[model samples]
Target: MITFESVTKRYPGGTVAVDALDLEVPDGRTMVLVGPSGCGKTTSLRMINRLIEPSEGRILLDGRDISQTEASELRRGIGYVIQQTGLFPHRTIVDNIATVPLLKGWPKAKARDRARELMDLVGLDPAMARRYPYQLSGGQQQRVGVARALAADPPVLLMDEPFSAVDPIVRATLQDELIRLQAELRKTVVLVTHDVEEAIKVGDQVAVFYPNGKIAQIDTPQRLLGDPADDYVENFLGFDRGIRRLAFFPADGLDLQAGIVLGDGTTVEQARRAAKQAGESWVLLTDAGRLPRGWAALSDLESRDGREMLAQMPLAPYGHTFRVGKDSLRAALDATVLSRTGLAVGVDDQGRVVGVTSYERLRAAIQAAEEAADGQGARPS
Candidate 1:
C-alpha cells in the first residue's frame, strides 16, 4: 500500500539520512526496517506519513503522491507509534486513546466508546479506562499507545521502535500481541528496529539496511535466515541462524516410531509380554476408546503379582507432548529434551497414542534443512 520510489533525505550539513531507496510494503502485510543506529530506518518510516519530507523522490500512498496530500489529513489515516508512547499525563487512558477519533471529528461519547472497545481488543481492563497513564505499568502504557494508534482504524500503521523502551519480557509480550493483531487486522505496517531478532520475530518481510541508508536485502524472515544476500546480511543474522531456521521447518516430516499399545484391562503379564515382543521397554496404556492413559514399564509389570491390578503399578508420568497436526518442532524438541529417553511422544488430536519421535529424528530433520539451504546457496542467483 506504500511505496518509496528513489526516495532520499539530506540534511543542511550534507548528511544524507536516507540514500536513494526504492521499497514497497504490500497491502495488509508488515515490513520491518532493521539495522544499526544512523542507518535511517526511522527516517524512512517517518517519510511515509510526511513527518519528514523526502528531498529527492516522490512517495506514493495507494497510487497517489503523498506530497499532494495534506499533512494533517495524511497523518489521520496513518497510525504513528514511537518509543516513549507520548501519552498526555493529565488525560485519562480512555481520553488518550480517543485522541485520534476525536481529532477526526467523532462525537465525544462515540469516540470514548470506541476507545473502550479498543482497550478491550488490546487485552486491557476496561475498568482502567478512567486511570491516568502514570497509574498504569510500563506495559499497560504501551498497550494504551497501541490502542491510541489503532483508534481510528487506519489502513496503515508506522511503528518506530515502539517496543524498545520496555523490558525484555514486556517487549516479547508486545511482539506477540502485534503478531496476533496483524493476523486479525492485516494492516499495512512498517516497523523500525535495530534489533534483527525482533525484526525476524514480527516482520512478514524485513529490509536490512546498511550504514549509508542502503538496503542490504528485503525478503521474508524464512528466506532471510535461510539465505542472506551478502556477508553483511549473514553477519547480522548471527551464528544462531540455523536454530532460527527451525522456526520455519515443519514437524510433520519427522519420522515417528509406532508406539507399543496395551489394552486398559489387560493383565500385567500380558502387557509385559507384548512390550517384550515389540522390543519396547514401556507400553502405552490405553482405554477402550483408544485414549492414552499413561505409560507402563515392563519392569513395573514384572514386580506386580496377579492379585494386584495392572493400574496399581507405578505409571511413568507423561511429559510435554504435542498433537500430531501442529507445525511446531520447538515443542517436540522441548518434549525430547525433558524426557528421560530423549524422545517426544506424539498423540493424536483425540489423545490417542499415535507414535514417538526420537532426538535422532529431530537432528536428521535439521541436518536436511541445512543441507538444502547449502545447496540453494551454491546455485547462482
Candidate 2:
C-alpha cells in the first residue's frame, strides 16, 4: 500500500540520508528496513508520513502521491510510532491514546471509548486508562504508544525502532504482540531496526540498507537468510543463518514412530509389557480420555513396588511437551529437542498422542527444506 519511487533525502550540508530508492510494501504485509547505524533506514520511514520530506522523487500511498496531500491529513491516515513512545507525561493513558482521534474531531466519549478499545487490543489493562504515563512501566507506555498510533485503525503503520528501547523480555513480548496483531489487522507495516534477527522474526519482506542509504537487497526473510544477496548481507545475517533456518523448517516431513501407549488405569506390569513389546524405553501415560498426561520410563515401572501407583511416580508435566500437526516440521523438531530421547511425542490438537518423531527424522526434514529452497533458486527467473 506504500511505495517509494526513486526517493532521496538530503540535508543542507549535503548529507544524503536516503539515496535514490525504489521500494514497495504490498497491501497487508510487513516490510522491515534493517542495517547498521547511519544507513538511513529510519530516515526512509520518516519520509513516508512526510516527517521528513524527500529531496527527490515521490512517495505514493495506494496510487496517489503523499507529497501532494496535506501533511496533517496524510499523517492522520498513517500511524507513526517511535522508540521512546513520546507520550504526554501529564495526560492519562486514555487521553494520550485518544490524541489523534480527538484531533480529528471525534467526540470526547467516542474518542475515549476508542482509546479503551485500543488499550485492550494491545494487551493493556483497561483500568490503566486513568493512569498517567509516569505511573506505567516502560513496556506499558510503549503499549499505550502503540494504542495511540492504532487508535484510528489506519491501514498503514510506520514503526521506527519502536521496540529497541525496551528490555529484551519486553521486546520479545512486543514482537509477539506485533506478530499477533499483524495476523489479525494485516496493516501495511514498515518497521525500522538495526537488529537483523528482529528483522527476520517480524518482517514479511526485509530491505537491507547499506551505509549510503542504498538498499542492499529486499526479499522474504526465508530467502534473505537462505540465500543472501552479497557478502555484506551474509555477514549481517551472521554465520549462524543456517541454524536460524531451522526455525522455518516444518514438522510434517519428519517420519514419526508409533508411540508406546498406556491408559491411565493400566497396571504397572501392563505398561512395562507394552514398553518391552514396542521395543521402546518409555511408555506414554494417558488418561481414560486418551489425552497425554506424561511419560514413564520402563526401568522405573520395573523397580516399582506392587502397590505403587503409576500416577504416584515422578511424571514430567504436560506443558513441557510439544505438539505439532501432521504437516508441521518445525514443531516436531522443537518437540524432539525438548524430549528426553531426542524424540518428539506427536500429539493431536485434542491432546491424544498420535506418534513420535525422532531426531534423525528432524535432520532429514531440514535437508528437505534446504534442497527445496535450492531447487527453487536454480529455476529460471
Candidate 3:
C-alpha cells in the first residue's frame, strides 16, 4: 500500500508541481493517475520512487515512510517504465533486462538466465535475446522495456505513458499484455497517462488530476462513467459515457424471449406450426444443438408446399450470437443492430441457442441499469 498525506513539491523558484495531495493506492491494484498536461502526474509518480523528493508531507510505502529509506535503495525496489523504451542501444536485450540484477551483484550467468525467463514471461522469444535495442521494432523494444522493469520483480510498478510511444494496434496489444501480466503477478501498479480511454481499460481505480497538482476525482471506471462528481469530471468522461458504461454490464439479466427457434431438418409443416406458435412471420433456423444458422420466413416455407423447411433458403443471414451469460450489453446491442431480424441471438457458452433479445428490450435494459445505478448513489443529485 502507498499513502500520500499532504504531499507537495516545490521548485527552486517556489513553483508548485504537486499540491497538498492526499491519496491511497491499495496493494495489488492498478492505480492510474490521468489528466492533461501540467497536472503534476509525473511528479507524483516520481516522488514515490524518490526521484523528485516532496518538499512537504509524507509518503508511506507498506506502512514505512519512504522518506526514511535511502534514495538509491528506494529506486532499486520500484519498477519504473517511461514513454521511451530506455533500453541501452549498445547492450543486448538480455543484458538490458539484466541491468538491475547485475547492479545488485547477481552473477552474470544467473542474471542472463533471469533475463531469458523474463523475456518469455513478457511474450518475447529467446531468439531476440542477443539483439540490440535498435534492431527491434518500436513495439518489440517496448516489450524489452517491460521485461527489464520486471527483472527485479519489484512489488510496486510505476509506468508513465509507456504505450503512448507505439501505434494504436501495438498499444492495444501491450495494454492486453499488461492486464494479463497483472492478473498473474498482481503487482502494486501505479500508472500515469493522459488518455482517459487507456485509463479505463487498464486501471482498477482511476485518479483524475487537474492543473496545478489537484486531484479532481478518484473512482473505478464503471463508477466514473456512470456518475461524475462534477461538471469537470462529467466533461472529462465525455458524452458517450452512457454507452461506455454498458460494456461493464452483463447481458445475463436481460429477459430473453424464446419459442422462435426451429430445429434443423424440420419439415415445412413443422416450421409453420412453430412460427404460428411464436406469433412471428419468420422462425430462426438452428443447427442440431440449437445454434443459430439463419432466418427462414414462414411464407417461403409455406410456398414450398412439400419440402424440408431447413432446406429452404434463408431471408437474411445471422450476423453473430452474443453469449447469454458471459457477454456484456454492448455485445448484445452490437449483435442486435447487425442482425437482419432486428434481434440478437442469445446463445450459451457452447453456442447453443438460449433465446433472443430485440433492440427495444436491449435499450430498456440500459435504461433500467442506469436507473438502478442512479438510485445506488452513483448519480449526482
- Using lDDT as the measure, the top candidate is 3
CA lDDT, every prediction?
0.87, 0.85, 0.88
> So what's the TM-score on candidate 1?
0.86
Looking at model 1, report the run of 10 residues with the lowest lDDT sum. 372-381
Of 1 and 3, the candidate ahead on TM-score is 3
Model 3 residue 236 distance off true place after TM-score fit, in angstroms:
1.2
Worst 10 residues of 2 by lDDT: 318-327
Q: Candidate 3: which stretches are off by over 4 Å?
A: 272-276, 279-282, 298-308, 367-381
Measured against the true structure, the TM-scores of the candidates, in listed sequence, are 0.86, 0.85, 0.92
> Quick one: ranking by lDDT, best first?
3, 1, 2
Residue by residue across 1-381, what tens digits does model 3's lDDT show?
A: 999999999899988989999889999999999988889999999999998889999999999999899988888889988899788999999999999899888999999999999999999989999999999999999999999999988999999899999999999999999999999999999999998999999999999987779888899888998777888888887889878888888898788877777677887788888778866777788888777888887778778775555646655677789997899998899898788878778999999988888877897888887777767774333
Compared with the true structure, the alpha-carbon lDDT of candidate 1 equals 0.87
lDDT of 2 by residue, 12-95 (tens): 999998999999999999999999999999999999998899999999999999988999999998898999999999899999
Model 2 misplaced regions, further than 4 Å:
259-320, 326-331, 371-381
Please give the RMSD to the true structure for each candidate, in Å: 3.4, 3.6, 2.4
Tell me which residue pairs clash in candidate 3.
none
